[model samples]
Target chain A: MNTKSDILIIDDDKDMVETVGTVLEMHGYAVRKAYNGKDGLSQIEKKIPDLIVLDVMMSTDTEGFDVAYKLKNHELHRYIPILMMTSFPKYMAEKGVEKFQHILGENWPVTEFLEKPVDPDDLIAFIKELLDEKNP
Target chain B: MDQGHQLIKDQLFFRKELMERIDWFILLRWIAVALGLTGTWTAYFIGYPIAIWPISTILLFCAFYNALFFFTWRHYRLFRSDDIEYYIIFAHIQVSLDFLSLFAIIFFTGGFFSPILLFIFFHILLTGILLSPASCYTYSVVVLAAMGIMILLHITQILPPRPPLFQNITLPSSGSLFDILSLYAIFSVTIIVTAYLITSLKVSLRTKGRELLRVSKELDASIIKLKALYGMVKEMHTCTDLRTLTDSATKNAAIIMGVKACSIKLLDDQRRKLDFVSAYGLSEDYTKKGPIDIGKSPVNLRIVKGDRFSIGCIDEKEAFQYPEDIEKENISSLICLPLRVEKMIIGVFCIYSGTPAFFSSEDVDFFSLMADLTAIGIENIRNQENKAWFVKKASHQLRAPLNAAFSMLDLLEKGYHGPVDPRQKEILLRCKARIKLLGEMVGDLLKIGIKRANMKMSALFDVDVKKKLREVATFYETRATEKNIRFQLQIDESVPTIRTDPQLLDHIFSNLISNAIKYTPAGGSVSVQLSMDNKKYIVFDISDTGIGIPDSDLSNIFTEFYRSENAKECTEQGTGLGLVIVKEALDGLNGSITVESRIGKGARFTSRFPVPV
Candidate 1:
């Protein structure tokens, strides 16, 4: 069995997925890519990853959210964490207090939200931290 | 009846009631005359000797008074019926005459011994019903005294007593001492009792009438206030201009309160002074002497602190601020109401009257309602301005980082930091493209946001439609060329330039042209045609040779975030918000758009905007 920590990236934007995957791979984490939510779910079912990198807007808007909810609720992949990225930080902030509660509440399914075009160094650091926490 | 105008209405009601009573009295007087003539003739023919001269004289006197009352009432009508006091005196004179005639008839017929003396009580009852209880009592006393004197004279042999000619004419034992006493007691008691009963009924009727009058007056005043409030609230919506709002507020306040002048004073920016914002029916000198210092003017400062106060006689106060000014201006009464939005007091609404004690409690209450509505309008306008400002600020902030991201990515693709291989270069190109697309989408979305916020505030200017359209065409030519698509621009010289917002016009053309290019496939053509249609509308026809919209999705073409199946299959980067922005921008211009399309054939959009006069 491959002992390296595995990360699954679900995004419709192939270039963004590749860029993030390349950064995570360089940091010694095995990275897998799925072009859409359906592909990501099937891939995670075959072998669950330590963490999932999800895009807020995809083939259809909110496709990433659908996949994240599916993975978090699945018995086999329930332990996996999800990191969400979006192009519209203001829009996300404008969802108001109820959205914040769901995002930061104790039972929140997603780990964190980050803005798009994330710094390459920060992406690798985030993946390593999530993996270490999950394994430990 | 306290004032001249009030007397007019009360006098009208009184004259109507008096005419009705006079009609009844005239008919009664004629009936008494007829009865006197027939009864005297019948008594003579029946061999019953009676005193006919006295009854005839009294009947004549009754007829004379009835004629005089009727003629005088007619004359009063001609002389202005509002002189109701004259009618009251006339009625009093009639009542006294009625008592005199009844006394004369009773004395001539049989003195206090005649049963005809009971008719004296009838006149007393009429007097009680027609006049006040005090007047009725005085008439009752005169009748009683007249009967007493006739009795005393008859018993003392000073005046001759007539013998009862009619066999039924009985005089309580033929005027003996005890008989006279009992007759006097019975007459006095019956007359007094009738007067009391009639007077009590009259008093209650008057009370009810007065109460009805008061209630009706209050109802009229309230209806006037409610209608004025309704008119002012309706006017508030059309008064989008803040200056016009204040001006209309003062004018309407003056008209509604029946005041000589009205003014609105708002706290200045520093809140240390109250500046006169608007004034109606005030002299220029008076308005110019304003901008009162709140620290120095205690009364005005109290109003600004949310206290309502009024002065019934401004000229009488020695230490009053603006006393000299108001005295010169002939302003007698003044009311100041605090204009409040929720708990925050923003200004004072003031009304001045030339007559002292003019602003009643009801007037103040109505003014308070108006001031509260004005405050709400002020708050509404302030909130709209704040929302517009916030939108501008937020868009500016959002645009900064998005542009930064686009520039940073551009620098990255240019190998500013390092050299890149073919594989890295390909990846960089994709990233740059994605970044560029996102940047464009954000810019379009913000344009929509800003345009919505600026609907009320956007300034208009003369625009060269052809020039703007050509500029947009040039800007999008490279994007069209990248896909090997052709672009054609046609402008009819007859389509003159129009007046519109320049930035909004640019957005309109840019969005339509950019959408055409974005949706059209390689080797397709996009053409724009602008011309004057029917001399009233400027028509724009933009046709694209590309994937056409489905019939089922045509209705939702302008809905935000709605992309058709064909569109999604053709392009992954489409935000589906461009047409929505275009439609909204056109709506602001009072323009309309239509589309015609068939699957795989092509699509064409036509727009028409009314030509500005």
Candidate 2:
């Protein structure tokens, strides 16, 4: 809890971004917002955050993935902790996870997956645990 | 042998009679001419004061020529008309001419009792037998009138009251009364026999002609029915639409069977109820009743109960048991045939006739054949539709997972968690590539489904092909460079902007370029060239110095579910649907693709599209 964590939220949904941002901010975490992948990547370049929270269907349905792919491959930003969130059905989630595993492997830089509508408390707990682990 | 001999004898006799008639007419004419010349010569050589002989001889010559002209004219007219009535009229004219000539000969001989007068009786007998009774009676009356006129002239001394021209011959002992009596008796017998013979012959010929006409008409009707059956079979063979096949069958059945109405009712997938799919002449009120329960309806019950076919008469059947609806609907007779496909009854075809007892066993058999053919056609179309529907549904279901996978990969790439090690980074990159491959497969599936359903893309707009190609080329250029392969784009400046679905265009170009980069080895190059042809067609040539396809796989490259042997061995990532989707998309735009390749050499794909005028 003593370790400060900066979280970036990239999503086209203003409501989702604001809600998730407020929830993480209430837990004493620094929060940044980017409405689209292009803006999110520019923000990341200026200041690489501790953790990035990404929504899959933003700008275009696959924009979040395109941004993640570019960031993960970029040598400078490849090591940042990332948490993926989606509201798709379970079968879709499985397929998505399978694809993600294929691309990023079992030990991908991302921390974990959060299916929406995300429990605010759970989201905070995961963030705190990851931040603590980073400090430890 | 006896019948043939008798026929020949009869023909000979007829010919002999015709020749004899011709000979007599010729001999009479010659005699008349000779008599006229001799009489005139006698008057001049013997200095006889007989002016009557020359005058009578000239009259005889005129009578002969008049008879000859009348006979010849009548015979020619008979051949010209060829009608039975005209022949009858000709017969009468000939008979009349014969009588007139005989009278002239007798008068010129200066007596009422000349021997040539007997020829008139023979002529009357011949006319009675040859012609019908009507003509015979007419000739008899004329002959009697001529005889009376001759007798009156002789008694009144109006026929030149001089010595007979053959004064050397003795007077006949037979009386004038005897000649008159014999002639009257002959006329009476001729009339009776001619009437009986002609009437019998006319009645028999008419009966035979009517029977022949009836048989020929029936044959023609049968032929028409057969032709219709042949046409229906041909249509059924090629039919892909269930509704059209059912509609055509019902309409054609109603027409060919002469039924008041025909309808087809098929059970839905549940098989609990029957839905009327097509109707020919049913009332709108009945049609609005919608699908009926097969078990509840009496007509369907009978069809299900009977193994072969079922026939029901609306009038004879119990009102309550069969329902008054059918009777009120004016369907007096109903023939139901089960449409069976692979031993399962999928539907029933019912034909209604307004009259009771309209359909027979034969009608039921014929209808059953039609139903069988229709069942096969319907089943085939249903199978195709079902397959198409599954492909669409599967593609839709697959989208959700694909989206989630893509997003998850995106998050991992972004490093939302702690820093990833190099190994982890490599795995994540591989995962991204695989996810991309899955996305492309799903996209191909979607494109194929849309093509099959004939659904147009939601978005269409004018896009610069050159700009799009350059963008795609730039995106994939690094990947190609990583493998030491060259990626180049050659776009014509004159090429105008094309109206197309942008997303679809992106997909097409990405797939082509990706494949080119994937298959090409280091030191090889991939080129994408866009140009406008002479015919104002936009052509794209994507040439790759990649491991080219074999000659054997070229034809099947664009087929769905068909993977080339070489491509499978070279790469296992593709769904083998890239070219299939490309072909379908191009087909929608009225474009075509042609490929040229060799086993070891590079492959070139040429896509040609017409510029919108």
- The reply for model 2, stretches above 4 Å from the true place, is A1-136, B1-183, B258-260, B268-272, B307-313, B316-332, B341-344, B354-365, B383-429, B435-573, B576-595, B598-601, B605-613
Model 1 bad stretches (over 4 Å):
A1-136, B23-111, B132-212, B268-270, B284-293, B312-333, B354-365, B392-548, B561-613
Query: What is the overall TM-score of model 1 with all chains considered together?
Result: 0.52
Return the TM-score for candidate 2, rounded to 2 decimals.
0.48
lDDT string, candidate 2, B212-252, tens digits:
65677678877887788778878765544566678888888
Question: Tens-digit lDDT track for model 1 on A78-98?
Answer: 788888776644333223223
Provide i-RMS per model in Å: 6.5, 9.6
Which residue window of length 10 is worst by lDDT in model 2 chain B? B166-175
True contacts kept of each: 0.00, 0.00
For model 2, what is the error of residue B561's alpha carbon versus the real structure, in angstroms, after optimal superposition?
A: 9.5
Which candidate leads in lDDT? 1
| Candidate 1 C-alpha lDDT tens digits along B1-613 | 3597786776677677766776677677778777877886787678767776767777777777777767765666536655557667767777777777777777777877677876776787788777789988888888888888888888787786776554465544454688778878888898788888999999898889878887898899889879988898888756644566788889998998888899988887788888887899889888788688888788887898888988888744543567677788899888999989899888889999999888788788889999999989877766766675566446545543554455456446655446778888788778767766766667677667766665344445688988888888888988999889998889998877777777667767888888888889899999989999899998889999989999999999998789999988987777778888888878877899999998887899998888878
